[model samples]
Structures are given as C-alpha cells and as structure tokens.
Target: MRESILKRVAVSRNVLTMLVALWLMLTMNLPFWRSVWQGVGGMSNDSPLFLLSLPLFVWIWLYVLLSLLAWGRLTKPVLGGLVLVSAGASYFMNCYGIVIDYNMLTNMLQTDVAEATELLNGRLLLWLLLLGVLPALLISRMPTRPLTWRRELAGKLGSMAVLLGVFAVLVMSQYQPYASLIRNHREVRLMLVPSNVVGAVHGYLKRELAAPAVLEVVGADAHRISAVSTQHRPRVTLLVVGETARAANFSLNGYARPTNPELAKRDVINYPQASSCGTATAVSVPCMFQDLGRADYKDSMAGNREGMLDVLQRAGVDVLWRDNNSGCKGACDRVPNEDVSHLNLAQFCADGECHDEALLHNLQAYLDGLTRDTVVVLHMKGSHGPAYYKRYPAAFERFTPVCKEVQLDRCDTASIVNAYDNSLLYTDHVLAATIDLLRSNAARLDTAMLYMSDHGESLGEHGMYLHGVPYAMAPSEQTHVPMVLWFSDGMQRSSGISADCLRQQAGQPVSQDNLFHSVIGLMGVRTSVYQPQLDIFRGCMPATVAQQVERSELRVD
Candidate 1:
C-alpha cells in the first residue's frame, strides 16, 4: 500500500506540471510575451516593471511550458481542473497590472538592470525559456499511476476552499488600513503577497474601518469674491500639477543645470522656498488641494474644508483638468477632467503608451476654445522615478553614462543623477512650450500659469530609492521643490501687478495652502476666505509675522 501511494503522488506532480504548461500556451496574452521579452533585455520601450523581477520572470514561463506535454498522463479531469484554476489566477494578475498600468518587464530601465546585464551574459527572457524545460523534463520521466477517487475529492475540496478564502479576503480588505500595502504596492505582488494576505485577514477582522468622507467648504468662501470683484475680468489661471519632482536637483533652484533657462528668461515668480505637504500623491495631492494643510490631513472628514477645484467652480470659473498622471485619485472627480495621455508625442517612441507630453497636445486646443473665464489644471508625469530613462526621448540623452537599470542604488550617484537630469531636461521643454502657448493667448485675454509638484524623491540618498516616506523625517530634497508662476502681459495688467515687484518677492516662502485662496484673489474673486494678507499678490505683507519668517527662511539664496 505504501509503495502504491508513493507512485501515485509522483504521477500527480507530473500531471500538475503538464497542465500548467498547456494552460499558459492557451491563456497567456501577447502583452505577456512582449513583457517577458522586454524584462530580459532591459528595454522599457514598453512596460515599467520588467527589469525589476527579471529573474523570476523566466521561472513563470518555464513553469508553463513544462506543465503542458508530459503532465497530460495524469487522470484527465483532475489535471484539467487545476490547469483552469491556475490559468485564471495568472490572467487575473496580468489584468491587475494593466489596471495600474505597471509593467514589471520595464521597471528597471532607468537604474541598474542594464549595468547588471554586462556582468551576467544572461537574459531574463532566455533564462525563463530555459526554466520551462526543467518542469517538462520532470513530467516526462515520471511514471503514470492509478488515481484514487477519495484523494481526488479531498484535493478538489481543499482548492475550492482556498480560492473562496482568497476572494473573500480581497473584498473585505479594500476599505481597511492594513491593506493599504496591497493597494499601493500592487506591482510587487509576489514579494508582497504572503504578508499582505496576513494583513488582509487582520484587516477584515478590524471593525473600526472608517469610510472616506466628503469635504465641505467653510471659513473662507470664494463665491462672494467673484460677485463683488474689483477692477478686472477674472484671470485665466492654469495650475500645472507636477508629479515626483525633487527640489535638490532642479537647476533653477541651483542644482547645476540650465534646466530652468526658459523660466528664468520670463518674468516668472520662482517660489524657491516652497514645500509639499506630503510625500506621496495618494496623500499630498488631496491634502494640498483641500483646505486641510499637512497638520489637519489625518482626520480629513471634519467637513470644514474645500478643495481648490471646489472653490474655483463655486466662484463660477470654468474649470477643466487634463490628467497625464495615474488616474486623478478622485481629486478632480467634481470637475471636467480629460485623459489626454495618448496624445503624448513620446508615445510614438513609448510603444503607444503615454506620458507627460500627452497633456500638452490638447492644452492649446482647450485654451483656444474657452469662451468664459477659465481655470485649467494640468497634471504631468514629471520626473516620476525608478524609470526615468523611459520618460524622455533619445534626443534628450544629453546626460550620458546615465543609469538604465531599475535598481537605482547599484549605480553610482553620478549615473543616477544623469538619468534624473535627462527627465528634467524634457520637463524644461514641456514648460517652455507651455509658456509660449500662454504668451500667444495672453494677447486675447489675461493668462497665468502656476506650476507645483506633488512631492519630491530620494535617489539612494540615505539608501532610499523612492518617495512616500513619512513627512517629519523626509529629507529636504524630498519636500523642497521648485514652484513658479509665469504671468502674461495681459494678466499683469488685469491683476494690476508690476513684474518687478512680483519677481523681487518670488524667492519668498509660500505654502500651497495659500494657493486655494490666491487663485480666487488673483481672479479678482471677493469671497470672505480670499485673504489678500496670505496672497503673494499682497507682496511683503504676510498674514502673520511667523508666516513671514517661514517664507524668509525658505529663501536660502
């Protein structure tokens, strides 16, 4: 009986392997193969995460190939069921990748994957193909054995229970705090799974989960401001929201570049002393746009606040948002938002995927047709790191010896800096082009552009590769960012502003908190909350002595 059971177990293993192979051949999509290929070659010409997990990539393909041929000898029904289940699981994972627009195959193109290639002569794609052979060999050598009905029944029951449990946990964990790791780190699913699964269970049991709250406008309202406006037609204010731009590296703020050459040429207001309220888009974006400053972001449900969009819309300003970043995270849910990511010129080289330039294409179109006083928000995928090489075109490869690998720490600081600078170079082009557009339109109406980043990044500084660190200990490079306001001649006249005075005050400290009210104030809106005392337009007369000091400290130059 013991010998018979041993033979039967061996047969089961071979059958399982064969089934997985057949299923992959049938269910794996073209994108999957393309990703596998890109993963091995350090080419982000397509996806993002390909290089980060190159080693494990081949193993997945190998598992599939080997499971198909020799494994078919196992009892037909049981093997067929397992194949179907595994196929579904793998397909689901791939779909999740698409939802987040993260492709593991190209993840390392910006940092260390290419450098490592020189040392290992091994391609992740090639290795993955080789790995597939191992399972094929295993199944071919195993002897076929008779199946036991009772054993088969037990296995099916166990698999069903596990699948149901996984599904239930995923649903229950959605609104809870512990599962934030899953929501935020979906790209690193394999590494994150076991712990996330454990966290999910705990998250399900925790009953105190808080539902997201709707914020209310209070204290300072912009509605009355527009109704009682002073001497001007409202300004056409365009706030360009930047993603993942760090202050330490910007040449305009003194990082050693001609990156800000264009902005410096114009009579722009450079708020070199500005800081982001949070470290990640998930936190900082909503916090910055809403009435809640960094201090009050945690309990955002008090309903004592309003977002920048709400305030502008309330004042009867025509508001529109063009997003090139990952979906708006509900920040622009209340406004007219357009996904112009596909129009990005870079997409031609980016394998049809979009980036920052996509937002710029339709921008002039949107500006040209607006009949009313308008406020447009442009969100850019600016300097979002870990894959900087893929963000720009080869023409901007001026900073060479740039790291093309994703493991940023493995490369020298100079190489990492080079890659980042290249991305910044492209940003410079986008900004210059945008300025030119606004300048041309300013002749017809008052126009201004305000650009601010969500948060900064850490590139191997103290051994961190990305942003999202807690705020209190975040490095200056991660919080201090380049903030600038570019005003047209018409805007200056309408707002009754002098370029020389604004430039003199440009280096002063300004928090994004002032932005919500400043927009309304600049547009000549007269809400009770529109505090000119906090407005940069007020020039040197800050609301409080402490705010004045804070602004002064920010002006290091």
Candidate 2:
C-alpha cells in the first residue's frame, strides 16, 4: 500500500507540472495568438516567408517565457498567480480593446469598492472559473516535489541562461523587422500578456513608492480686492465637476439630440470649443485644479503642490467639496470634503449607488451656514459608464432598449448609444436643478454656476469602448468635454460682467487651463500668481472696470 501511494503521488506531481507548463505556454498567450492571427488575416498578398516567420518568432518568445517560469520549489504558486492575472487581463483587453499600462493600473488602484463591484458579471465569473480557478485548484492539489538545494539552484541558473540565449538569437535573426513592427504598431506590444501586466505593476509601484517633494504653496499673496463696497453680498460660486460627459453629445454643442433642454431654457453660456486637460479622471481632476497648464503638467508635481482650492482657502474664502462619484483624487485633501455616495436617500440612491442629485440633498443647509465668500464644488457622477443605464432613474430613460449590461460588447451599438444618451439626459436634469438652486439663493447671495466634465467617453468608436487611452493617442470622443456656465443677475452685477460679454468669449478656444485663473478673477482675488492672460473673465469684464481692478492690487506695505 505504501509503494502504491508513493507512485500515485509521483504521477500526480508530474501531471500538475505538465498542466502548469501548458497553461504558461498556451493559456496565458491566447490573446497574443489571437491578435497575431487577426493581423496575419488582414495582410493583403504578404510573402509566405514573412507569414511563416511570425509564428516562429512567437513560439520562441513563448518558449523563453515558459522556461523562465519553470524553476524552483515555489514555481507552481507563482505560475498559478500569473495565469489567473493574465486570464483576467486578457478578457478585458480582448473585450474592450483597452491596454494595460501604468496609468490603467493606477486607475484600478484608485477605484472604490462600489466602482470595482460594477465590473463583476456572469461572463467574467465564467472566464475566471475556466481559466483561473481550475488551474489554481490543480496547482494546490499537486504534491510538492522534493529536490536538493544545489539541484534547484543549478536548474534555475540553467533555465535563465537558456532563455537569454534564445532571446539573443531571435533578436539577431530578425532585428530590422522586429524593430519596425514594434515601432509602427506599439499597441501590439502592449497586448502581450504577463509582460504588460508585470511592467504595469512595476511602474505603478515605482510611482507610488517614490519620495514625495515638498509641497509648494501658490498664491501666498492672495487677498480679496477692496474696490467694491464692503456691504456687497458675499459671492457663492458653485463649480460643478461633471464625469464622462462628451461635448459631441450635448445639443448645446450642435448635437442632433436635445440633451440639454433644461440648460437651454436658461440663458447659459455654453463653450462649444472646450477641451479637457486629461482623458481620465485620475489625471484630469488633479490637473484641472493645478496651476500648471497641459504643456507643463506633471502628475507627480501636481500631487506635491497647493491647487486652486488651497489658494481660495488662503484668501479667506470658504471652500467645500461634495463628491457623488469617487473621491476627489486627492484634490480635496486639504479642504473640507464630503462623500455623499453612501447616503440612504431612496429617491436618489439604490443598490448602494446614487444619482448626481444626491449631492444636492441638504446642500442648502450647508450653504446657509457659510458666511464668508464661498467656493462650493459639487463632483457629480455624471454619465460614468459601462453601466450608463444605472446612472439615472427610470423616468429619465427616454431612449428605449437601453443597454443594461456592464459588459458593453454584449449589447448592440444602438443600445449602447441609447444608454449613453440617457445618462447625458440625466446629467442635463442635474445641471438644471443646480441652476435653479443657485437662482433660488440669488436674493441673499451673488450666485453663479460653472459646469465642466472631467473627461469624455467612447461608445464602440474604432473598437474602443471606454476612455483612459494615453492622451497623445486618445480620440476626440475621449477629450472634447462639455462646459456650460450660468450667472444670476446678482452675480452679474457683483462681478461687473454681463452675459453678452461672456457669450462673446465663449466662442474662443478655452480649456481647463482657464478654470484656475477665471475663478480667482471672478472672486476678485488679487495676487501675483494670477495670470490675466489665462483668465477668461479678463476679456469679458468692462475695459475700464478691468483696468481699475487690474490696478487695485493689494499692497502688503
């Protein structure tokens, strides 16, 4: 009995090793194989030799990867983890045409539990079970192989040398073709499994673990101007930061659909030529509030500096950030911030998620308590997708047969657009409600509202289903965002600017760069850091009034 048991144990261990090797060599490379096959199929009248060389190159690459993974006692566990992660990454890339890069991994790290849970679906579960869980189970059940330390060390060294040799020969044989292919089709390299995942994780770790620089305080000389009478009502400016709202879909920007009926009714100034600072909220949210423009913007530098909100607070203006989507991406770290996503309001929230309207709940009480000049920022969960249909209530679903699945590929293109348009409609309603709220408070405060989205979305355009592509390579559908402004009569008089003047400036090219200086100019804050050239309000204010304010700098003497 003992002899039989030993033989059975040896057989199971060998079987497990073979299974792991097959998974590493084939299962993890499924996406790469498919991409290669598709590329070859699209080739028109290509040489037979070139086609034959491609598969040979891929085989050598896989052999190197498999050899490197097949050493040491803990090899099974490490290979198992890689297999699972590769499977998950492959599914997302194949289904969504998304590249797993450092920015994407960073976005994943920043995702909240609620946002992460939305990605869970029956199809994902099925794939995980087939490709991940089964392999992991086999690995766990396999008995450990007993080997001497010397033998294991020697085996690892031998495998490393073999892989290096194979890689060197492959590079030498087809250096020119390989270089040209990688240079022209860079995205194809990003589709390679295990390498992309490992590189992305390494890059993310390097960024997160790097030593942070000293926080540079901007607008230290900031002080409110005294040109106006002391009895003038304090300003109440509401900065509505929208999510994933593309300008191409807004009727105010010449879309065929009337997506902005409510804002249209109001005499709002819609900037049709507006653009976003970045293509993802992870980058754009912080960039929008930073003093640096897009050309000089660096994510690491932005994280170590005081933003526009800090400058407003330093100037004795009250600043509040109420978030309905994910948190403020550290932009609100130094200010008073609220997360209203967990509120149990049945009218606005369901299944642990809430519409943008939830941010408006109890907002009046919060505003009434503030006596100083206030800058209130409401971060709305506007049109954030693959679950666009979940963003609004049933009443707002005017478009029929909307996509209800988080996996957008499963739905038809029309259904996807219908669902996205419905989300935009909801966003319109939310913005209109905010305008009404500001109008209601016009009697007591000089009220104004500014709305702009963090970034745009891509609904099945060019095989792309969502945003977060690198900005240089991103499409206009992911960069051109909607920006609208509404000013009450009280606000117009207090700021010494007219709606007509703002309308004229609306046609000029503007971006998130204008936001920092424009807000400070509107609030009448005098500081050396304020650049009049970048201020959109500078062109809109009366020439004499603008000259008087420009000369009325608060001297510290």
Candidate 3:
C-alpha cells in the first residue's frame, strides 16, 4: 500500500491545477452546468457548435482562474482549501437549491454554533468525506516535477496567455447570445462552485472590515403626543420578531393546515399580503427596525443610523430586547437587550438551543412590574429550519410522522411540511399566551402585541429546502411572511384603533417598510421622521379617532 501510494504521478503545477479544475467541473458544478444546459435549449437547439463551444468557454474561464492561484510552495495548500470550500458549497447548492451571494455569506458568518451544528448531518458528512477530504489527501500526495525558477515563471505566464486568448476567442464567437443568456438567468452564475463563495467572501470582508461608521442619532426631537393628558393609562406593547415563519404555512394567512389554531381563536388581525425586507436574518432584522425602507436600505449606511428602537426610546418608552434567536443582527445594539439562548429552562431546552418558550418564560412578571409605558421586543426562533422539530415541545407535534432530522432534503415533502407546521402550532401557543398575559393586565395597563417574521422559509419547494435565497430570485415562500396584530379593549380605546377597523383594512398590503412609521404612530409619538402615509395603523383609524389624534398632536406643538 505504501509503495503504491508513493508511486504518485508527477506533473507540473499548471498541468496539475488544470486537472483539478476539470475535476471540480465534473464533481462540484453539476448545478451550474445544469443551469447552462436548460438555458441554451438543452441539446435540442439546431446549432450544436454554439451549444458545445459555450460550455468550453466557461471551462476555460475557470481553468484560467485556477491557474493563477497554482503557484510555488502554496499551490497544494490553496488548492486543498479550494476543494474543501467547493465541496461544501456544491453540497448545499445542489441539495437545498440555494444560491451563494453576499447576503448568504452574511448569514453563514452570523450563524451561531448551535445553528451551524444543525447542518452537520449524514449527507453533508458523506459529501465532505468523498469529495473534500479525499481530494485534499490525494493533493497532498501528488509529486510536482522540478524546474528552475526562471523556467517556472515563463512557462506559467505563457500557458496562461494562451488560455486567455482561447477564452477571448470563444466569447467573441457568440458574444450577443452568451451575453443575453447571462442577463436572462442571473442565478446561473451565482451557482458556480468556489468562485461564488470566493466572491461572497470578498464582498463581506470589504464591507464588514471597512472603517466603522459613526452612529448618528435620529428622532431626538420625538415626544409623546399625550404627554400632558391624564386620561389614559400607561401602555405596554410586545413586538415579537419571528424567524423563518412563512405566510403560506400559517393558518391565519389561509394555510390549509391548522397551524395557528390558538391564534385563530384570539381574534388577531392577520396581514395576508405582508412581505419581508430581505430573505435572511442578517439583512431582514436590521432592515425591519431601520426607518429606511427595503428599497432604500444599504447595510453600510444602516450601521450609522439610529433605528426605530432608538426613536421609541427617545420618546420615553422603556425599551428592552429579549432574543431567543441569534443576536438582533445589530438592530438592538443601542437598546437594553438580553440573549435567551441556551437558557436552563427545563420545559424548552434541546440541541444547545432553546425554544420560543424561553422568550415567554417569566415574561409576565416583567410586564407586571412595569411602572410606565414599555416596549419589549421578543426575538423568536420560529420555524427556523432545518431544525424545525426542535423549535417546539413534543406535545406541539400534533402532525404525525414529522421530520425530526436537520437535513430537510432527506425527509419526504409531507414530513418536512409536518415538522414546519408543528413549529407554527407552538408559535401560535406562545402568541396566544402573550395575549392572555396582556388581557390579565388590561385593568391597569392598555396592552397590544405585534408579531412580524423577519423572513420566510422554503420547505422542499422547487427543490429548495431552506431560506436565504437572493431576494430578486427568491420564491414567494421565502419573502411572504406572516404579520399578526392583537390589541386589548383598553388599548383600542386609548389608541383609538380597534380590531374591527384593523380587520377591514387587513386586505391591503403591509411590509417591514411600514413597521417604523406604523410603530411611531401607534405609540403616539410625534416626531419629524414619522410618515403618516406609511403608517398602516393611520389608514385604518376612524375619522373621529383621526380628529381626536389630530387634536392630541396639536397639544404637542
């Protein structure tokens, strides 16, 4: 065995790298090639020459890139790293049908240990073992032919120039058709192995490691509209920011399943047409809190600006963020916040991550002790896959044959849906419990609760199993999120916004863009940044109530 292993074939570095690139094209880029095949008429087109040459064009492009990195001393190490990254990226892209982009990279970077552990299942292990580790081991054993320094440099450049010239000729042969193909199917390029991941890393490092932006305080001039009025009691509002809860699976949003049985009976006003700011937590959570709407949102600029939390806190509302998901993605950086992950709570602990119950555990006591107006933001790990079974307790698994595995693609489609729906059932219980707590406190404090998911998820839809697809190419399963609102009788009277009025306007479109302005108006905050047109609550307000709010605003002036 040792003699056989030592008898490895010897090749020059450029020749070895070319073979490695070819291996990558065959093993780790089926999805990329598949996209190309589907786009160019898939072998049925009459022009066999154009169809065949187009793929060679891409192969030469990749070969030229790999050749640049195949240099002395670091060639094997860099190539080994490339194998590992491509194996992992291809495994996910092929299995989950997800595209690697800047935002997806941000999710991977921000993902905690528990979330990362959930992905270490049998399929991924088999893939890494067969493709990543074995290739790396063989790369380590390969013997390179000896050459003088001058000869090596000259040969490398000469070979690279020839390949570049060939690549250029191929592109110019079918320039317009190839250009149109790329323009029509943008996701095809994003599916490329290793290169997509490399580009994403470059973008992430460029943005995150840049000089930190200076924080600019906004809505400093904000004040309560009825600060001087003594008629109403102090308000208590609960904003539950949910994770990966798609609208298509929620019973409140017309899902065929009874996922929201508890919430369905609570008379909550469900926004059927609600959408998210982004397709991942890292982007959606921050964008949800910032005043800038999704279209106007830029991460670099968002870091420097104060969000709605700052504006609400400036208006004298006692703001606190309780996170049961990953830390607020910088949305709660300025406010008082606590992480509820890995809590020792006996009823809702598993897989090194706690359930949504952690956010609600002893939450009433905190609300009961509120001396003044308060806003508590509960960040829930609702239906966050591919560990949907772990998001809820066993009793909530009303759907039989539920998928308990983390690798959602391995499970059948029915089992996957059952597991995800079970999570929604548990979330419904949490939300209903919150409403009950607010109802119990209705005598002294007028209370309300608003639950909006940061983004949605895809469960075996169009061969996709998880979230974080690019927004432009994302399916409705990843962008259409559930938005639920419940107000107590006291809150309705005090805020002059009733459940009936909310139900009437529930059919209108609502999104995270309206969250900032809606909350500002809901809390009776008078600020320069408040846009009444974007406030969903304002449009639903009665004419008499509008007049009353207008008079109350007159007092602020």
- Predictions in order: lDDT: 0.58, 0.80, 0.85
Per-residue lDDT tens digits for candidate 1, residues 1-557, read 97777676665544354345444444443334444443334453332443333333333433433333222334344334434433333332332222111112112122233222432323333333343334335444545554565665455445445544654554454324224433553333332211222243343334114534445654344543322233244458888888788877777788777666666777676778889976667556666676546676642332234566777776667888887766555568778988765554644325544656676775677777776677888888788766677777788878879988665645788888888888887877777778888888765668888888888877776545666544655677778877878888777665556667878877778776777667766654555555567677756323453243223321100
Off by over 4 Å in 3: 1-8, 227-232, 301-303, 542-557
lDDT of 2 by residue, 20-66 (tens): 54565466566566656565554562545555566556555644564
Name the candidate, 1 or 3, with the larger lDDT value: 3
Model 2 residue pairs with clashes: none
RMSD of 3: 2.6
Residue 334 of model 1: what lDDT? 75
Clashes of 3: 0
TM-score of 2: 0.90
Residue 421 lDDT in candidate 3: 90
Q: After superposition, how far is residue 164 of candidate 2 from its true place, in Å?
A: 3.1
lDDT of 1: 0.58
Query: For model 3, which pairs clash?
Result: none
Q: What is the lDDT of candidate 3?
A: 0.85
Model 3, 1-557: lDDT tens digits are 76555455678877778878878888999888888888877868666777878757767777777777668878889898899999999999888888999899999988988889988878899999999999998987798877887888888889889988988887788787688779999998789887798788888878776726678777878877763244458788899999999999998777888999899889888999999999999999989888779998876644677898898888777899999987887778888998889788877876678888888888878877887677889999888889788888989999979988877767899998988899999999999988988899878988899999999999987888788998999999999999999999988888777678789889989999999998878888878888898888886777987877777643332
Mark the regions of model 2 whose C-alpha exceeds 4 Å error after superposition: 1-25, 28-41, 45-50, 55-71, 140-150, 211-214, 228-231, 301-303, 555-557
Instruction: Using lDDT, rank the candidates from best to worst.
Output: 3, 2, 1
